[model samples]
Target: MSKALLVIDVQNEYFTGKLPIFNRDASLKNILKAIEYANTNGIKVILIKHIIPSPEAPVFAVHSYGAEIKQEVAEQPHNLIIEKHLPGSFTGTPLEEWLRSNQIDTLTICGYMTHMCCDTTSRQAVHLGFKVEFLSDATGTLDLSNKAGTIDANTLHETILIVQASRFADVLTTEAWCQL
Candidate 1:
């Protein structure tokens, strides 16, 4: 079975400055390991970037600097870059076509905002009939606040990982992923 590594949204926004997550440096290290494994194993590495358009200037929206993939994860000519406007990488993107063209049946996904884009894309991948594997340690999110006050990002991240593991995909650590 053909397999691909989908590195989703390891962007500048989530790693540095105000929007930084709790344990970003460690997450980036894990993601880099996954990328290195894909590079050595001949697995296609597809990097997904999320673009959120500015509201005031709808037509000419300034791409959020944080939205850009972090320099650490930038393309190295051999990797393919896929731009996505929504939470799910496959939605409104050429990801499906590219996967079909490359005969990719299994996808290993790692990215930011564990409860949002990463989880959404993993579910969608399964729905679209692709075998999905999520890198547990390679994904993370910022703390979220609700009416009940703030929720720990790590708690939220692990909760979603459990949910996805129970229903959608095989959520594994970077080491487990490398073995695959």
Candidate 2:
């Protein structure tokens, strides 16, 4: 099966901007390892960037430092760089077409905000008929509190991994995924 590692939103926004991730160092380490493994194994790699087009955008403004991909991951060679404005990587983007064209049947997902972009992309990949492998430790999320009360980062991240494993994806740790 053809596989591609979709490195979603591994940008400075999560490191230095308004929203920061939980256990960031660990996640970054695993993701960097994953990228190296993929490159060595000849698997395709696509680095995704989420840009919030507004010039005054609080985060992810296009061409801004916040939206720039993490230098550790950015300096590495990749097959493609997709820019998106939504939670799902495929939404309003050439990601799906590119995947299909490249004959990628499986998507290995990792990067920021486990409960948001990672989950969204997983579900959408399943909906679009592509198999998904979600990296648990390679993904991270921050605590969230809103009208629906509060959810800690660990709870949110685990809950989404549970949801993904239930049907949408094959959820595994970074080590397990890398070994596969």
Candidate 3:
């Protein structure tokens, strides 16, 4: 099965901006490792960037510092770079078409905000008939508090991973995926 590593929204917003990723060091390390492994194994590496159109936006505004891909990831040799405005990478983007054109049947997902972009992209992949592997340790989120309730980073991350494993994707650690 052909595979592409989808590095979703590993941007400055999560690292140096408003939304700080929990376990940033660990997750970033695993993400870089995953990319290196994919490169060595001939798997395609795709980097996704998220942008908020409004210039007044608090984070990820277009052409803003927070909207830029992290320097480490940006320096990596990637097959493609996609800009997305929504949580799901495939939404209003050429991601599905690109995957199909390249004959990629499997997507391995890793990036910031486990419960947001990562989860959404995994579900979108499943719906588009592609097999998905979610890198559990390489994706992360920060503590969230809203009208619903408050949840810590670890719990939010685990909950999303569990949900993804149930039906959307095969969730595994970065090391396990590398060994495969």
lDDT of each: 0.84, 0.94, 0.95
Q: Whose TM-score is greatest here?
A: 3
lDDT of 1 at 104: 95
Model 2 bad stretches (over 4 Å): none
lDDT of 2 by residue, 1-180 (tens): 999999999999999988989899999999998899999999999999999998689899988999999999999879999999999999999999999999999999999889999999999999999999999999999999999899999999999999999999999888898788
lDDT of 3: 0.95
Task: Give the clashing pairs for model 2.
Answer: none
For residues 122-169, could you state the per-residue lDDT of candidate 3 as single tens digits? 998998899999999999999999999999999999999999999999
Rank order by lDDT, top first? 3, 2, 1
- Look at candidate 2 and tell me the lDDT of residue 13: 92
Q: Which 10 consecutive residues of model 2 have the lowest summed lDDT? A: 171-180
Q: Estimate each model's TM-score.
A: 0.91, 0.98, 0.99
| Candidate with the larger TM-score of 1 and 2 | 2
Q: Model 1, which residues run further than 4 Å from truth?
A: 55-61, 75-78, 147-149
Which residue pairs in model 3 clash with each other? Answer: none
- Which residue pairs of candidate 1 clash? 13-66
